[model samples]
Target: MALDEAALETLGLGTMWVRRGAPSGQGVVEDEPALEEPRAAAYETASPAARPAAVQSVEAKPVAREPESQSVSAAPTESAPGDTPVRPVPPETAKTIRIAPAPEPEPLDEPAWDDFEPVPPVGFDPAPASAPAARSADIAALDWEALEARVSNCERCRLCEKRTNTVFGVGDRAGDWMLIGEGPGENEDKQGEPFVGQAGKLLDSMLRALSLARGENVYIANVVKCRPPGNRNPEPDEVAQCEPYLQRQVALVKPKLIIALGRVAAQNLLKTDASISSLRGRVHRYEDVPVIVTYHPAYLLRSLPDKAKAWVDLCLAYDTYRQAIPNDKARS
Candidate 1:
């Protein structure tokens, strides 16, 4: 059956139609060209091979997204033909930074010098050096009183600078038996007396062994009156400067026999650098008086075995004393 306009409109077909195989001019009905379908129009206009691509282009239009941060610029990107163009974001203005300068350091206060007296450096000698030759004559003529006074005020050598007290000879002035040692030690320097320490005690013991005591018939002296710093041996110049005092003592005492204790005493008294071992076991002479050498008490304390040798030296000294004073009966 032939459809009317309402039926054709409802069926979504063209409004007019012709019978099949009818004469071209006999039943021809003219109507406005039917509105073409959108997809069909695109397919008819586009080439058959490009129809799928044309449809895809319309369906997949590219979108231009805004950048997440306003400070950063969007990178340039390519787009398909129908896509929107992307706008670049301008860079944010550079930020300004400020810095502060460091604070200056505080000044320190100066030390107060007026609070205390200044100490002199070690080995500081204030007195001028005097000639030994000029002083020797004056010292030689001084009796015990003047000699001691001179020694007490002596500045002959640098050893005087650090000495606590001058160690003059101790015991009887007129004693027949004289014992000479090296120099004053710390104890002797403080006491201003020689052989008064542990060494002094040992010496007293040794004297008792010989039936003798200090200040009885025994006199004690040292090579150097002043103590060397740290109990060091007296230097050659120190010995030379102090020799006149020792010589004066020897002349006054006129000891029958002299006992030179230790290597320093033996070497300095005899003017020989001979070892104590070589100087021992024999009677040596110093200014016409017999001299005997022995180990120092300080040395014996460290070397207990050598005490026997020191005893032998004491026996030798006693024998020499008896030989010199045949008429004396106190020790006989």
Candidate 2:
């Protein structure tokens, strides 16, 4: 119990006392006089040299006690020995505070894959493969005739009316590396081939640099067959209509590596709108084949500086091709 002022002064210390009582059977208490107040001695001021005496007060208050009865109550009653005190209606101490949960974050709205468009870097070329024979064998098994037939009668979109011929792809059908361009240009539309014209020559030279041939180790195609008048990007509807033909070719030929030659091809095939800089220098998957995206040959023809980057993509494609079909037996 806390020490009263009288008890503290009498003890000359901060000490407190817990009153004790004998058992009910042993001894009974009779009415007694009030406790006498301790005498307070004078006001002796402390000198700088003499410090106040050390006092250690008991920090804890009294523990719970048993109940007791009283004749009359003036102030709040305290428990005597062997009696529990009526717990003072516990002081309304502030209750523990709690913080509410944060509101759920709003969900983001990302564009769908089909809606994305891939844009290739100005300067870059895809790599060539080593095993042209194995690659060609795989492609030969697929029906290019069926693919052409499908494209020939394709009236899936309005472009069918404007198209001269169904530019049904060109180059090595059996090639290990497939070159996919955006769509046909004037020359390609007229010739029913992909990458014909000055750009095609440059592309051929690029293939030759890596010891590749046009109709030998490399195959070329585009996302759309018809030229989008004045060489504009093909419309979504046009690409949507023509895509099945390309998909069938890819499935039949099963090229070990697919080199998306431009933003349009990369965007359409990879289903991503990220720029070529972001897509380059990394390996991507197209169905079961490894795909290395790079700039279009036309773009490379326009910007000579990008040749080095194109070389990098080419090297990457070659490395991936090697990894895909390790040996002759693996192709079987």
Candidate 3:
């Protein structure tokens, strides 16, 4: 028995089929009537008793159709009673998703270098600097009165701080014998003169032994004009500061011979660190003047034996003086 169009459609076979004797390329059956619309309407309207026996027989024995290997286009379609509706899936496409970059960090506000100032460390206290000493050239150019004035007001070293007076010097300015001693002691500082203590008495006796006296042919001075505190030895810097004054005095006096009394005087005058004992026998020269080393009168007071040595040094000085000035008859 042959199945009609409505029965084939009901069984999901909606595609047209060619008859066995249909033309080869025409794809239509010859002499067949058009049955699509009329058959589909009849299937919908006809009752169970009114339907064709062949259609009813085909419905009772339905044929299953094989699934086609083709892509289906998504389209909306009506559903029959008791059927579930299917949703169409959309085709995949290449999409571009852009992510905003993180915001850049703001620059920090910094202080300028010009606004910074240096800070000194805690508990720091700076000492006041001492005044600069006078230049040698300036001191050399000064005359007697000018040099004395300068020495009176000099503050070139720390020794000036404790001095009661500056012992500039005493005796004849043109004396042929120049006696240089160490710094002043307590009595000399108070009297504003060099060797005015018990040391001064010993020095006077020595001077009389040679037929010389202060303010006569003997000019007296010292390595330093100011007295050291506690009668301690004058420091090297203190001696250096006062050296110009002594040099100027030597220049003005133009002494025939110089007597350096004690280790300090001998060392500084001869510019030697040799001990007084080693220096005693030698004839040293200072600014072209013969220098005789002797123990200081103050030293002689403490050391009585060395007094004899000092007399020998004085005798040597007198001999040297005679050689320098032969005609002058001071003493032997």
- Scored by lDDT, the top model is 1
lDDT tens readout by residue for model 2, 60-91: 24333222442223254335767754323221
Model 1 is weakest, by summed lDDT over 10 consecutive residues, at: 23-32
Better of 1 and 2 by lDDT: 1
| TM-score, every prediction | 0.59, 0.55, 0.59
- List pairs with backbone clashes in candidate 1: none
Candidate 2: 10-residue stretch with minimal lDDT: 34-43
**TM match of model 1 to true structure:** 0.59
Q: List per-prediction Cα lDDT, in the order shown.
A: 0.80, 0.69, 0.78
RMSD for all candidates, in order, please: 23.0, 17.9, 22.6
Clashes of 3: 0
Candidate 3 lDDT over 1-332, as tens digits, reads 13565466577454443333322222222212454445555666677666675344323232232233323432334455665543332223326679999999998898878668776589765443322333677888999999999999999899989889999999999998899999899998998998996889889999999999988988999999999999998888899889999999999998989999889999988888989989987788999889999998888899898878888888898888888786445444
Which parts of model 1 have CA positions greater than 4 angstroms off?
Answer: 1-131, 327-332
User: Which residue pairs in candidate 3 collide?
Assistant: none
TM-score order of candidates, best first?
Answer: 1, 3, 2
For candidate 1, write residues 1-332 as lDDT tens digits. Answer: 11353365576453333223332222222231332244346656788678755444433232232233532333333455665543332223346667777877787776678757678799875544445565787888899999999999999799999999998898889999999999999999999999987999999999999999999988999999999998889999999988998999999888999999999999999999878899999999998899999999999999999999999999999999989897455557
